[model samples]
Target: MKKTGLFYGVNTKKTAQIGKQIQEAFGTDQVDIVPIEEAWKTDFEHYDNLIVGASTWFDGELPTYWDELIPELVSLDLSGKKVAIFGLGDQAGYPDNFVDGVGILADAFELAGATLVGFTSTEGYDFNKSRAVRNNQFLGLVLDLENQSDLTAKRIAAWVKQLKKEWAE
Candidate 1:
């Protein structure tokens, strides 16, 4: 069976918590939860599927650790790998740049030739603008933990279901 890896960059623990939620929803021992600090040592080729999580910083930047890991991520041969992304951001606070960190990661993965999956609809979210949105869709799952914490679990569950379908295909 192909293994799954969940890697995350955390600051306020919201991203970490979302990673944990995904780990639980996947319900498989083959899944590995790795912090961005240690993800540099991870063998990207070992996992057939990768789920990356990050919390957006001011002005739509990725968390510091994710920014640091980008070089290593870019150095990997991720072609044919299934990659998914998730991000935590404060839409109420940063309406102009909500969850843009996910877009940065998505771009990096795309550049590495990974097959990015799990793009989510931007229907219910209220944000003025975001790099994460393209053609009225988020690059991946996006959580507004500061303003919409109540929807996190449901959104995660739905996204995980979508991922399962995508990975199986």
Candidate 2:
């Protein structure tokens, strides 16, 4: 059995809702969800899979907790860990920096040697720019609850299915 850990930082609770939905989809017994405020207490090395999430803040910055968490992430060796990411952003409000926080987290994990999974297609999303975009795809699942709340459930369902397959590989 693979143990999974989910860590997230949220502002308007939308990101937290998304995290909860993902947790439900993955099964409560399989995932341990931790808010970013308490993430330092989590033992990342204990999980076989990791899911990190955050809402993009002003000017493409990561959420507050992530600012503190980044250093800890850098010090850990995550080689061979299966990591996935999710982020919330308002494309209409911050078109140029949409979901950039997800990219930031992804980069940190990559630097720590984690194998990031769940790259999502950029189709159906309206945004001028995002650091999360690499090769025309989001480095992870990107949700725009401010602009597209209706799509969240379906998107999460598909992403969770994708992650399950990726984890199996």
Candidate 3:
């Protein structure tokens, strides 16, 4: 009943909050959100489940930091690793750019030999949903890795229950 590893690819403040929420909700004391810019090969190996997040720049353009980090990521052999990708963007401003960064992570994670867990999608809450998401705005949709530790924690708690159910079968 111990949650093992989780990693993030963003250096933004949101990443820390999301990481903390995951740790608290899943009851996993061992959780670290490493910035992709400062990531090392050893970082990839130590994690069982990796949660990667990044922000869109230049009106949905890819941030160089995450892009630069990607080349290094594919070199790792994440055979048994599970991946969850989240992206930050303004869907209203850059509708076309929504969730594009996700594919990059998914493709690279696949190349590095990892399986995606839960769901994989982008979450541009700031502009997409007016900074206030009602109901399950992005839960099974864009895959919200959002603020709101209380709500986020609750959703993750349910996901954990579902996760165990899936594994049990």
Candidate 4:
């Protein structure tokens, strides 16, 4: 069986949704969701395959908790671990080169010694610019990439499946 892990940007229903999909895809409890803020940061290397996500803030920075958590992750040894990344972002309307918190999380993951499998963006579904987002509702700018509604979860689930396929080799 594949030992899977999930980390979220912050505390939100979106993170919970991401957790549910991980549980389902990995077969009931085969997966674990750790808030990058709450996790020990160093526990990531304990798993074989790691999937992580982040919700974007106005400046495209990781949430406060995730911000403090990066250094810990950067200190781990993940040399050959399978990794997948997902992020929540909205269009900056500038040059379209923005992808929310994607880059922030990717950089940390790479520095931590893991090799990323791939990535995707929800694209154009930004909520940080309005009160609607402050109200804690969801905008579909991003997708689950799976049948679920959370793009982060969908991406993680897909990544886990891909790792399984790779391991069989």
Instruction: Give every collision pair in model 4.
Output: 122-142, 125-141, 143-151, 144-150, 144-151
lDDT of 1 by residue, 44-122 (tens): 7778999998989989998778898788787788989999999989888999999999889999998888999999999
The estimated TM-scores of all candidates read 0.94, 0.95, 0.67, 0.68
| 1 versus 3: better TM-score goes to | 1
**Local distance difference test values of all predictions, in order:** 0.86, 0.89, 0.57, 0.58
Clashing pairs in 2: none
For model 2, residues 1-169, the per-residue Cα lDDT tens digits are 4889998854448778888899999999889987678766347777889999989999999877898889889778888899999998999999999999989998899988899999999999988999999999999999988889999999999999999999999
Pairs with steric clashes in candidate 1: none
Off by over 4 Å in 4: 92-97, 120-160, 167-169
Error in Å for residue 76 of model 1: 1.7
The TM-score-based order of candidates, best leading, equals 2, 1, 4, 3
Model 2: lowest-lDDT 10 consecutive positions: 34-43
lDDT of 3 by residue, 45-102 (tens): 8876666665556544456777777788898899977665555544555555554565
C-alpha root-mean-square deviation, each candidate: 1.4, 1.4, 5.9, 7.6
- Candidate 2 local Cα displacement, residue 121, angstroms: 0.4
| Model 1 C-alpha lDDT versus the unseen true structure | 0.86
